[model samples]
Target chain A: MGDLNTVVQSIINLPPAVILALGALLIPALPKRLRSPWFILLPVLALTFLWFLPVIQLSDYCIVAWNYADYSIMPYVSDNLSRLFSTAFLVVLITGGLFSWHNTDSGEKIATLFYASGAVGVVLAGDYLTLFIFWEVMAIASTWLIWGCGDVESGDVGMRYLLYHVLGGGLLLAGILVEVMNTGSIQLQSFAGLSGSDLLSNPGVLLILLGVAVNAAFPPFHTWLSDAYPKASITGAVFMSALTTKSAIYVLIRLFPGMDILVWIGLIMAIYGTIFALMSNDFRQILSYSILAQLGYMVTAIGVGSEMALNGATAHAFSHILYKSLLFMTGGALLYSVGTNRLSDLGATLKEATDQDPKFASQSRWLFGFYMIGALSISGLPLLNGFISKPMIIEAIGEAHYEIAMLILIAASIGTFLHTGLKIPYYTWFTRDSRSGSKPLKQSLNSKASFGEIPVNMNLGMGIGATLCLVFGIAPVIVYDLLPYNVIYEPFRAYPIAESLLTLSGAFFIFIWMKSRLLTPGVLRDLDTPLRATLPWIRQVFVDFPWAIFEKAEEIVLAFTRMVIKTVRNPLAWLQPYSSEEESTSTHSTEAFTPAIEIVIGLILFTSLVLGLFLIF
Target chain B: MINASNSERMNQSSFFTRLPLWIAILAAAVGLTLEFTLLRGYASHWWNHVPAFYLLYGALAAIALLGLSIWGSKVLNRQEAAGTNEKEA
Candidate 1:
């Protein structure tokens, strides 16, 4: 009985990656209708199992044996941080999966399962090697999701996406190799300082940092995200929004806490993402950009590296996954019903429905209401999820004495208000006058369009997420209890409440002012233009330039060959006797050539001269 | 019409774009100066500490330039729009 209990416990303690691998095999066998919902259930089951298992110490797992170096072995959950991140990841996977249930494609399910497994492995990894293995797995899986869009444009975007991630993975792998060589150990425990004295400061750390930055979608390397995300299938976009970057943030907090470079980089990303989001016209593109901005808050918080800051980072990550998924769900619903995600192609579907045509308006109202709640939550409006989570991050920044970081964060908050908070909902759901009535007319013209809402499964999935957003906003103690670190900072204090209200009111005033002035409808472009427009042109130039050179070279060779042939055919030439009918006939019959014999004679003379020089020397 | 040739078709200028090229040039100059002259002193204090300061300064300069560019582009856009309206009339 005792041994049986031990066996059961061991199976329960099997890392989420193993279960995810099993789920990947199980997914294809599932009926088409069951695939997505099964994915949602699989993560939930994993989380429940983790919750019930006994926690062990890091020493319990031997990641490297002298004989078994080549086989990748993962560490089970041993630390509070790993448990916290893993639990949150499981929740994200389930929620994201549920939200995407209406999307029936096999690729999204397979890719999402692999992506979730990678995130799980990262959180639970005992060593750098295991972490890197999952990291590359995530890169390949997410790229596949992007490629599953199945269009020429998406294929091109996916290639660019692959290029960036593969490069990142390479850098990370190199870093791991160097670290292993220096330390003779592969454990991923905390390390101090940046001088290459220890394994942490070696080339390995830099390479790993570069790799993490790519996944985080940090600048110059961020073009791949904005270029590909908006073009993803609606459900794929929602899942993509939640996982890859957050996993990078998780690893950053785990590996390099208090690295001051992260603080500055996070601040830049915050402001940069928000500014570009404000300029974008595509709805999903705006959301993609906002993901970068929100991640900045977490990355910056992690940079502070204090207990309060780390907690804030973790808490913000939890809330971000929920609200961001909600927003993407709203966008996905819009795409499904309207067949477009462009802001210019959107209108007030709710207002268009009259008493005789009430179903469409009701559905639109549900979607728009869901969208409003998500926007308000993400905007850090008082009493929503963002208000609760964002203030903790801001307090952490204040505690760290990073005044510039605070200012940048505030600017980013306001910019979030401008783009996601005000712009997205206003353009897609509220503004009836900006774009003509093309959308409504199209809907009315198609009799097959039933004016129905999204499938019950999808709506229920969204409802689950939306309810959690409201619950978390109203009472954040539920999340605080689950945090890896002991909570020292109180989020319900007067200062935080007052500050949040002030920001919300300030954003509201700005919106009113902009709306009154009719300044809100114009399109704003972002950093992706150079990538989307200029790079293709640049490639064309390079491609054509090389081709032009090749063509000229080919022409020269052809001209030379023709000249040789003309000279050989000339009756007055030195070879005229050899070119006589009988001699030519014999040569043609035997496949022999006078030109070949002459070339051999020239080669012999050249070699003899080279040999003579060698002998003399 | 999504005109490819119109200069106006270029993406909206942000802070990185609107900075006077000289400001960027000057910022780069300051960065290079710090890297060559002052970094050694800071590095001696603590190797990690010096890189931290450099990273912060670099970030601050980039943010300042970005903010300036965003504001400058908004101003330029307004002027261009006004000029185009006048020509139309």
Candidate 2:
């Protein structure tokens, strides 16, 4: 039994992230038929490795620790919190792969697998350094996903996305660097709620919050979500939606809970995203804004800072990933069947049609049923995952006596249904404004006529997602047990059910009452108005930046050349040309190079000062 | 002329249009009845657990958003033609 325990511990100690990452590297070389199965297999292997470890204290149970001379790093740590998120991430990886099975681009597959693995990497990281490494990996790999959506505009958008995240990464690294210098140890689990004085005293914590908040889409830093997500590939968006923001939320809940300002930031995001999403025309853009809104709930829960609220945040993250992926999968399927994502143009079912090859008739596509399940679940309808989890946070906030915050959150729930549940589906599948209503439309990704059915794998991905949503909802404890904290909150109670039903009814009423207004298909302006308005200037910064560098370098070289020419032509030019003395001091080499030395000295001092602070404080 | 497909989908999605009306009425009736039930909590603030509080709040929130959105689009939004010119620049 002792030997068996040792063996189990050794096997489980390997970080699932490393396994998935290595698996990603090997994917491009795999046989064509084997690649699809490999996608599902790798994440499953990682999950299995996470699950079967000997029960022990969190520090001892299946930990991978490395001691390098003076520095020690624990790269892999398994606890309930890590395992719960890892499980959700791996399942989404499998389903996302399934949905995009027909996309033959190996680069897309490899980048996506790496992106998913990076998310697991963050969850399993036991120290700040390990967390930073995974955080960067997720940022870079997800950028590739946006670019892989395949167009020149997507390329530029991916670059913009990369630059913003890089700024966030810089702040995070600065914080971690200062923290390690101050504390001289790398412990990063279970931070207690800090008082305002503690926060004021520490600059490191504030830097970390700013870094994480960018990814969480906290108000002013949020436009990146709306800008990039709508342009991502159908399957890629599914993966992107599940990981980046939620992982940031996980880090925040783990580290910075109970910050009073988080409540207001979250409420603003919830209402703000909801309103814009209601006004947006594209279904995917609507979903993108919905990400901001959904994240607001999780952020607010983290801010509320009770065991029940933390549990709600955890459970809600798990359920949101599943349903949001389902919603994206529905979009992917629709985009595959029809040629566009415009809600006004996208209505009509499959009709019988044979392609150029007489034997090839497209199969029957029934995505609406699965789509409705996702829509209703997101709206927090009764007997769905969002219902089971979202209410817990609201109840916690209300119980904690933030009655106004709770009211706003409930109102935002109405906005959630207004956009995601009603507007998107109502415009996409149920509208009668199609240009040629009776004829079968052609598919874009594949050159087949819209006829028989959606791809089986796509439907399977959505079905699995919808099933999990229903299961977590009906028997809510499955999610509750997996949360990092223990809390007793029941969802089947009357008050919550009453509120959820009423919110849905209210959203329904608003949608109808403003039906004509919302029926007009056009884009709403984002709060990040400057980003779009000055896009040309933003592009010119990048476009003009390299030439500016070259021009500066040219000036420096020309100055050096002129100095050399003068020295060769007239070595005594440093002497006064019209001085009373016929000759100046013969060798004043030191005085001649004073300005150059000053410039070099200034640069060196600035670099050392910045680096020295990290070393000292 | 409306196609068969359009009418069928309308029938299918009639729930979006009709269910709200029915559920709004039902929520009003049942929420009022719940005021007498043991499940209702103490009203710490003025608006706490008002009968059909969700309905009143959600409807008012929606209307407020609509009014604000109309004003924003008119005042804050640039023309689509302007967007094209910017992209070209």
Candidate 3:
């Protein structure tokens, strides 16, 4: 009885990431029937363990550590922040698992489990070393999802994705090493007190910031997201949409909250994501860009560094994960059902799907409803989750008296509505080619279409996410209670409602006015343009150039080897300087071993043999 | 109209064609009214003192963003290679 109690206690103390990771190892052995259920159950069990663990507290840290050599490695650290973020992650995992319930690919399933585990592990980690380990695990496992799509383009995109993450992981490791040496400790701590130029003095923190920035999709480094997400396996995109950047945001919230530079950086990201999203034509690509824009809000809140602001960032991240995953799931369903992501062609693609499966006719309407919930939630429409969380950051900025920053964030919100609320829904489900008198463009019909019925599980997954968005939106206290800091804030007030409605209305009107101008089907370039353009040159300098020089050197060495061999064969090939024409005409002349050459060779060999024999004697 | 399908012709005359514009106008009107009346007492920020500030600011900001994006499209949009676009996938 005591042993049983001890075992139960031990299991409760185990980190949620370890549970999922250990369960992931058993995936392949499970029968196909059991895999999906197991996947869903794992996160549920992890969440149960997370909540039931005795040490989890709101204000103080309760660490679960393993002593190794001279190090006290704390792998399970329970604070409100890690707990809240991990809860969000686990919830998304369950929903994502359900969404991909029909997927037969065990490789993708395993990768997803490991990927999710890594993300949860990062937040739970008490030390930098543990954080870096989980960070690389995330990088590698997520790359596997990209590759599992099994297309030439996805393969290429996955390689690029891996390269970026590996680079990020390297930078993080460098920072961690420097920090350990300088501080004589690997424990993670807040750099929030280091502001402005004081941050310049902490090279380790700066390196770590740069590393986390890469994963967070902070501009220039952000292209990997847009470039890869739209091309990921339909189900993979759903998980990818929720995990990577949000985990990085969690890290920022943990490590660098209140760093002043992040405010401007966040503002830039917000505008940058909005602009790029507006110009994009791919549905999933648009969502990916919006993730960047939304992440900007959280980053800004973290920069504000107030209790309400950090709480706001955490709440927004939690809500963003759900809604964004829902959007991606619906978008994935659209992509899965119609086999395309082009915004201008979505209506026609759905039209095409009706012929393949009659049920596909109504799927679009259902998907649109689900998609809008996500869209409106992200736009911070009143009564949705976005309204509950987004305004907190804006209000915090307002309270801090950075009036311009407040206004810019407000404008960014307007832009968010402009694209997500108006442009995406408008072009995807309702657009008509004016030239053709309300018909979808004829060219879109000419494209290949693989129309089918959306799986029931996909809808169920989306329904769960949509329901959570509403529940959280209507009851902000549920999210508020989980916040690390104690703060009183209200979301459903008259002023916020008016602000949201006015902004959305304004965006909606402009969208109608600029409808034609917004039909952007062309591929959009971003800061990644120079990188994409110079990729071949980079390959040439790094790969092809070195190989070419090596090849030339190899050829010269081979030619010298051949000359020595020829000399040994006849003893006259080098001694005789034949004209080029003579050498060309008489290919076999040297092979006949002339008597004079053979005699000289024999005499040299005899002399060498005699000298060797004398020396041995 | 000679080569058009029956559904295409119906789409041209459908209520859906005009519904969005009406909705946008209605929403704008309601938003302005709410900002001016019901929510006026809730104004704590300086910008809130301006008449229909959120409505006007939202509109102007959207227009500026649209202008900037249109310019951006010209500089940034590339012709995607055939069979390489996400639509085909």
Candidate 4:
């Protein structure tokens, strides 16, 4: 009975799941002015509950000797790590929800609720079974959000997106099943001691690693993310930018922290993402690719598997969810105002705005500036959130003595600066007269003036995300504390900070040099070219080819059938049978009748032979 | 353009119409032969091992049939082109 009370206490201590489930229902019932505030308040409440929850490990069910009577629900509040992830997740949800206060659509509201639910479920799940259930819920909910993009193209992308996630989910479930079957336990915890020999001895570990790898966007399986993310609605993309990959990273850190394959795989993904991003033309697509690249940094850190590296990965994940979301939100705002997202069609409308039009130019510039800050943070610019997290990873790579991995990580960082930090801002905000032919600059600017600044609630969302980016950047200690692992290494040591600063300054100089050379922005094709251009061409070739062949075959078959019918139906054809009947009748009849008689005699003889053999046996 | 001579028009359309199928068939055959020879051996790594050969064979057959159809179309087009050229002359 005392143990039951302990379980009840843990359950009660955890935030009510009903809060998120009922948030959408209650938000609309409130006055329009109060809606956004309430949305903001709900996540804060959840965060508060998360913070207050007592740390204790409890089992929900205990069975003795396979007896049904002893089964009981045991509640547990296990450790600080669960609290750390749950707290950060709730904080992101609160900030993101507040940021999206101006979104009036019920689709966003419901989807956001489910999305939050999925994240919370991941953070709180005690067992592999519980974790998987939430993992799939997250996939389904995010897909629904992508489907809310309200376009035919988005619909197509959404279906592909769902297929990939389902595949990942299936892999994850298979891994879980294997682990449960092998271990007779479903607990989700560190498998640090598992060795190569042990892994070979038990195949379940490999299955679990494969499952985690898919969601981590390990190469080849990563296409779905880049495919669907850019196609989502702006708000939906923001939510997506934060959750799925980060959850996978969290799971990897939790499960297979020391696996050496992760190191190489992470390096490959980072470079691959960066190179493709360099080639991308779309605004959100670049961000999507950047997400993969950024996840690579964390994954590599996890691969390093030292205390400092794990902490770095954890802290980086926290900061990334904030800054990346801000960048996406900024891009979304631009898309919302201007009719197009293509860089070649966008120009410095902010600079062109009349001083009299305070709102348009001022707000635009501010958003653009905030976006640059977010970019810098992601680029590992000094005195920002990225500065704190990225160096930790670099240090870990160095500590692990992986020279090639370190080199790749550094090169990828430079590439990130080249594409995202420099190219994105220069092309979208500062470039000269790209849209000259489409519309008169003044007229287009005037049309944009009418749309004015983004709605206040949207601005608030972006503002909150941007502020967190700066806060995390400026104060590394706060983020460092939030990490699940104990951090003995400091982010603010003068030598490391100076080194990172030098690297970033070098990257900035390179960006400026490239811009001077007019090499910052240009159309470069990527892997997507196959699907976008070549695959369709291939499909067209196949489709047309098969149709033509079938059509020709149909024609030939029709002709042959016609000829056969003509011969059969014509009385003259049958009547004119067998060469000159008068001349050959005697010989032809004798030949045909003789063969028929021989066949009949042969069958009778063979039957008799078979019967005689059977009788003898 | 439509009044071009038969041989000239056939030369032009043959490259566009027949080349893709020819390439596809050649690729399919190579793929099939590679799978049949290599995939059954222990020396082949799992990642590099070829998939079932039947898929390649089927692809080759489909492409061959397609090539034949294209060849037929080219012949028909040449005849039409000749007739048009004669009318023009």
Candidate 5:
């Protein structure tokens, strides 16, 4: 029928993000048994819509377009860049949904769906307002993923995480407003001119870049990622791992590609992450820091601003989402089964678990096997996903002739393998040495921690991620074809393979030599140390002081009202002096009116008389 | 050096333990050979022409990162547990 066709056409015109968001709202209403299935089905449906949609233009394919004032806002864009990023977000949603299948809390599940919708929306948005709205949605929804852990620390960590994001969202809004006022347009494509020093010279672009940098986990602004993700609920960490930073990278690729300042910022950020990851004792904390390191490579490629580099950044983001989520899933599985995330605690528990039942050790080995696949993939080992993408960025930098930047990135590659691939596994599963002298197993054994079997769903999620890593790595064309640019580079060639093997081998050898020294325990203070230390004082001065002043002013008004009531109700009481005892007990009471109150009343009466005379005249 | 796990100690001579070392050695040899022979023409960049450059570069870079990290860890190491010092006070 004609009416049915209209309905179908309308649904088809809806953005994929909006469909997922509407599905997210319906989650709690669904039966408990259907929640996980519904969660997985939505992204799959969105992915289908994403690919099957008709393309009007390959570069800026817009759908669901609407006008705001004089500006035409495209809420859904299906360019190659957006498509590549959206595909990753949607795929991770399915895998993350599967990982959290056993989670009883519908709030966290709903938050993740909404969070993915925000990320997808941001990537697909063709204008700044749409981008900013989804950017904040991602921030707010992701914060729930942290707080939904329902732990004592989760609340505090989530609050800090929210504050950081609110600040970022504010900066982004300010930039968008300034840019619209200056240029009279909100099109994101207009930022292509924002390259080199011109980016810094423009206040709007700089503010926008600063906002995106906060989400990208760029150095001093990056502590939130390390601070929050480890503290998020077990399954929530998996979703948080995939969405937040990569979406920022998507924004950067779309808006600020080729900004020269990013080159240095990204390089420092890469080393900063590696250094902190090396110092960390918590398993998930190390992974969080390594996310920063991995993001650095993509950021550096974006700074290069060539077709190959942008493609490399895009490809790396797609691959990073898969492998990193797998790593987090394994980390989450460890926390779920073992009731601890500390590396020192994990080694002892696994050791004790092995002593209790040998089979437990083998099962733990299977978890480790899944973990190593991700590790090797991230380390850019030959025949893995990292090899296919990371080399493109480094090769692009080499082509750009920024030899120093290239060398530092390669060194960072060595550090990545050292900390993540070698040190995390060695210290977590194999080491007998207790870097921290505390007997963590005592607490874990008595609590919910167990040597029992890991849930089947966890393995299924990890298996899906592992399969994708292999599929994409073996067939580089799959990822290459998804890229925004033509593929001219070869990852399988002799030079890159040799380079990856040599660097990874050298990293492996050094890790063997220095694994003991690297098995550090206890808190590794970062730049956030000073911030956390001063946050209380900062809050008191910035937040509490003004509030105190407002309260004092409110008290004065209440006192004056009481005096006026007494004057009107009993004229004799207004003339009578207060006793000293009454005055001391209640300073703001009607009985305690002083000369200042009388002078104010006299001035008011005089003003009323003058106003009355003027009106009569 | 990483101490062997109890299971690995029981089979100290297992090929898996030594297999990584062998692979590293062989990879270095093969990488060096490829740089000199079949991949010689692939050296479009100046750094690629340096003999066994990536192998040396990777080794030195690893050492430098480890050395710096050791010193950095010593400086930044906190005896207090995480989140304890920053409790909601």
Candidate 6:
């Protein structure tokens, strides 16, 4: 043990995020064939490095804290809490790379590596600055991943995704600045309830939690995930399912454990994700909502904040990354096979998979098998990972005396089943009608692109994920021993397993009986409506004001739009229609564009808006 | 339960055509039986081991959420075309 500690301490501790990010940078410049192999290799190397790291505790030097003037920024930590999550992050990255190996281009793979690294970086961060830097990297990298999907729709969704994250990043930066100013310490620890950087009294800490909530996909702040994730490329969505939100859950566990408000927030999220998941039209969209519901369990566990609850939260995150990524990979396979991602398109692909020669049968048969592993595991069925981890959280929270919260989570699992476990598979793989909102196989599948057999790499990616779900379910200790908390909770005990099984049983009867009512694909809207549709309508206020006021109002709106434009170029970019033809025409015109006068007006509006927002928020 | 040809019957048994729901049903029955007879299940909180606690609580909570989600879907659910580009508006 002493020698091991010495080895861990002596080695140069580079943050795994940096290694992956630098590796990603080199990939785009590499030859095409070299790029595909690097996608799998980089994450494998990072995981190996992360696996070799020993458990770190209370030691400043070994934790990789760097000093910049008065600020102590620790970019890497090797505590069990971070190690547990980092292990999962690398696992999904490897799987996602394999899933994408044959399908995606170098740019998409590069963004995925960076996104994974950002998540790994945030998990290991020991200070707020370190956390914030990686948090911003995640914001940009994930947006790039979405943008690389190569569709105008994805580009539009990518911009919305970027805007939400940038706002989240802005909030986090504001919180960090205030925290440093008021407390004079940069350590990444939770504020007290009402004193010593108390979130209750301290607006800064509250802001920081809100910032994390956006990434965690807490209800009302969660529309971006469902809106953008489904639009990303096959592999992009797979990489996405593993990171961002899970990293947010890690930060929440670290920073806001035992805060009672999280219990309520979590319940809302659990119910919210469960319900909304059932309403989506696409496979990935439902899974995206399922991700929200699942994160609710983790968030709720963090709120319970006992050692057992934290352990359950972390363990659940570790398991969820694999299953969810597999779910997305299956969705990607279906999407690649059938062209469109809508649930109605499954019949077109299923016919191409089955009902064909024996050769094609092996592919869809295994594809269905892999998809079910993810679905059953997510549903918390017996002898699967969800059974192992989901009930552990409920038992822990119940032990912590949050009975109502515990019961709500138990109930929410049914919702998880309704969508992810039941609806997604039934509709995506089982529904065999190429009618009404669905196109037939002949129309959808051309000779060039086929869904005959999922590529070996995609199958391997999903197969590994499914295998892990089964492995961890059969042997809970593989996860338990690695938990930050000492293990006492056992998932295989009779009563908890009985309770989970019966609950799934009872809810399933309702599913079979109420199948038609529940199966319809409907879009679920949230608080973001006011920001998207209502905001532009309200922009007409500038049109009706006094001429003098109108000019100034346009400047103010322009100033704010410009700020938003700096971070997000679309959505608002459409407000200014600048084509090359227009630019050329304007160049030939006598009208001169003035910069100084506009700058003065922008400055005044910018200052006032900031003052107003500061006073209001 | 009438007999079909061997090859005809063999064709009906593919694992691909159906599996998850059956496994769910199988697990549920097994769990229900174990809880009823041999296995004495434990609960972290009070009243968890009472007769049919899992069935009742889980059912109630699921129903409540389902009801709430249905109501929410009325307000929250949008048309398929709702995702059209915002720039047009």
Please give each candidate's TM-score: 0.74, 0.82, 0.89, 0.69, 0.89, 0.82
- Candidate 3 per-residue C-alpha lDDT over A198-265 given as tens digits, one digit per residue, 9 for 90 to 100: 75788888889889999999888999999898888888888888889999999999998888888888
lDDT of 2 by residue, A194-214 (tens): 744576578888778889888
Model 5 off-target regions past 4 Å? A1-4, A53-60, A553-617, B1-13, B82-89
Once model 3 is optimally superposed onto the true structure by TM-score, how far is the C-alpha of residue B88 displaced, in angstroms?
8.9
Output the better candidate (4/5) by DockQ: 5
Interface Cα RMSD per model, in Å? 18.2, 7.4, 4.9, 26.3, 6.2, 7.9
Candidate 6, chain A: TM-score? 0.83
Worst 10 residues of 5 chain B by lDDT: B80-89
lDDT of 5 by residue, A1-617 (tens): 99997677667767888988999999889889999999999999999888885443334477667788899888887878899999998998999889888875678778988899999999999899899999999999999988886767888899999999998999999888988889999888646646657866788877888899899988889999999998888888888898999999999998877877778888998888988888888899999999999999999999888899999999999999999999999998887776677777677666666665555666787788889999999999888898899999999988888889999999998999988888888777667455355543555443443465677888899999999999999998988987888868789988888898888877777777877787556778888899999999999999999999999999999999997886577655444456455777996687676565576689899999999999999
lDDT of 3 by residue, B1-89 (tens): 12233224334556856876786677677777777778766667887788878878888999988888888888888776665534323
Clashes of 5: 0
Worst 10 residues of 1 chain A by lDDT: A347-356
Candidate 4, what DockQ? 0.01
* DockQ list for all candidates: 0.02, 0.21, 0.41, 0.01, 0.34, 0.27
Best by DockQ: 3
Pairs with steric clashes in candidate 6: A495-B41, A523-B78
Name the lDDT value of residue A347 in candidate 5: 70
Considering only N, C-alpha and C atoms within 3 Å, which residue pairs clash in candidate 4? A56-A77, A58-A76, A59-A74, A60-A73, A60-A74, A99-A461, A384-A473, A385-A473
Write the number of the candidate with greater DockQ, choosing between 2 and 5. 5
> Each model's C-alpha lDDT?
0.68, 0.75, 0.83, 0.66, 0.83, 0.77
Task: Provide the RMSD of all predictions against the true structure, rounded to 1 decimal.
Answer: 13.7, 12.0, 5.2, 20.2, 6.2, 13.5
* Native-to-model Cα distance after best TM-score fit, residue A398 in candidate 1, in Å: 1.2
Q: What is the lDDT of candidate 5?
A: 0.83
lDDT of 6 by residue, A150-238 (tens): 66888888989998899899988898888889989998876424322356688888888889989998878899988888887777888
